[model samples]
Target: MKSVILSSVLPLATVITAVVGIAGAASAAEPDKQFFQSAEGKWIGPGEIVAGKYKGTKFNCSFTGSTPDGKVGMSLDGGCRVGMFTQQMSAKIERKGREGYKGSFMGGATGSGLDIIGGNVVDARKVVFTINRNQLRGVMQARIPDDNSMTVTIAVRVDDQLVPVIGMSLKRVDAVEVGSIAPN
Candidate 1:
């Protein structure tokens, strides 16, 4: 009965392989893959004060680049009330699930202490982050119905309870870059 046993085993193996292959493909098609892909590049926009005393000033900021190690470099110019400020910052960002990312930011704000840690959130067209109880929120919506351009909205929280301190809008910013970590 060796031939009979061999036939049964072969069919079972074929079925198992097919099932595994389909499962692998489905995982690869997950929505998070899109975020990981679209998140590669540079994004720049203007910062505005919406809710606080500094409600009308405009500032510039950018996410310079993203590394394979999940870190992103950020720079901010202006957007302060008391003094002119420029900042050089770096942070690691990762997709948590369904339009969410969590990471830590550490950098210097002009004329102030240089170390800070916070978490960030991102979706297909929006990004939000917080530093030391202060929040920076940005939303990107499509510009043209068929084009890739997006309108971006940015807001900040001024207090410990995460209140909205300021807000601004920007348009046509690029996406963030993402990739696998390189060998150190």
Candidate 2:
């Protein structure tokens, strides 16, 4: 009688364990969708280059992007006019994974550019982009503190060390539809 009871209890335990494991996996997947949605939008603000030839100079910066279903892409541009030191810079990004991207950065004045080798969005709030090629190695990070505000930091390698080059504060003035096409 005791053996019969033990056999029945063991099967019930196995069933319970399987059900619980499946439920846990489903819950684990919820954050991936939430994080993807939370990071899509258009953000704009003024920023300053902190550690280069243009240190202390200010520029108007704007970033626009969509990261839906783990697909990410964004475009960033900045321009500054400081009496004989005007400049424009731009970059384009496309996602490589849930938190990864590939892009390029270009300076309009010098026409110099670098390849963006890797990038990632973390916890739907913080973002990072990195570049490493030839003489250029740098990282750019941005964080959205709230629905309305964001901060950015850019660092470049100089003399074998990473140096901060741009720091920015941004505001979200608009939201973008992820898959809309413009009528041409």
Candidate 3:
């Protein structure tokens, strides 16, 4: 009689603990979804590649697209010229899980594409991602300083060391609605 009672209570306690754990995990993911939802709309402004092979070259980047809560979709495009060399990239990012992304980046017009994986949101205002292929590894970070500005940094792994390669800043561009405009 004593052994049967003890066994019955142990299983009931274990089931209760598991249910609570699942509820806690579901609640924890709500904040991440809210964080991504806040960064909606288009951000357009000027920036520069302050490191790597393109240091001191000024350029403009435009970021457009908004991810609905619990979804992911964003793109980035930057172009600039230094002497006879031109640099540019076009990439699309999609949300992964509760706080991560995955995308592909195409460097320049005729360049081979790189795979973007392991993207994560470190906080409410920062997003990071990694790219790896063969012997090359790279990390990219996008941070928001305020409601109107963003900063991007890119780094690559070389000789077992991670080195800064690019830095960029952009400002949020508000969209204009047709119905909101009045005849001048």
Candidate 4:
């Protein structure tokens, strides 16, 4: 019985393994804070909206990533440009309490953007955040494929599945690495 219960909870547990909390046993083996620190520096790259009505829209972006001193989170601030139009891009995620992560993007769900209500560090190379606005819910993943590149994808819940809506690929323009990345 215990085995069956543990099996059923493992999936959710995998993601909620204390990304919202103080650094604990769940993340002891993973350098969650180091991951954020390593992600610092300026990034530049291109991306496309691969799905939804905005599909095929292409844009370029530049951002600066930083981690608060003595903290286990990161803040990404920058903007994207589509033709002559420019959109400011910003996100901040910090570990809180003894549970999971919390932060915002563009702005909070109350302003013009979505709220990052919860999240977890999946591994050394990937972290997943849950975003919500009104009735629309989504998941954002930031994956660092190498020291010089990061990729971000936002997928919204469609019916019973999550569909990719926005993708960003960024390269470390200020660091010494040949790579590309994405934004939320």
lDDT string for model 1 (103-130, tens) is 3333222212211233232333333333
- What are the runs in model 1 whose C-alpha is more than 4 Å off? 1-29, 67-84, 95-100, 107-123, 126-163, 168-184
Model 2, position 123: C-alpha lDDT score: 53
lDDT of 3 at 47: 48
Report clash pairs, candidate 3: none
TM per candidate comes to 0.42, 0.59, 0.62, 0.78
Supply candidate 4's per-residue lDDT for 60. 81
Ordered from best to worst TM-score, the candidate numbers read 4, 3, 2, 1
> Measured by TM-score, how close is model 3 to the native structure?
0.62
Deviation (Å) of 1 in candidate 2? 86
> What order do you get sorting by lDDT, best first?
4, 2, 3, 1
Question: Of models 1 and 2, which has the larger TM-score?
Answer: 2
Predicted candidate 3 versus true structure: per-residue lDDT over 30-109, tens digit per residue: 54443344444455555444454445655454444344333344444433333555445445566555545555655311
Estimate the lDDT of model 4. Answer: 0.60
Compose the digit string of candidate 4's lDDT tens values, residues 42-114: 7778877677555687778777776666567667777766799776667667777565678766556676566
Superposition error at 25 for model 1 (Å): 12
User: In angstroms, how far off is 149's CA in candidate 4?
Assistant: 0.9
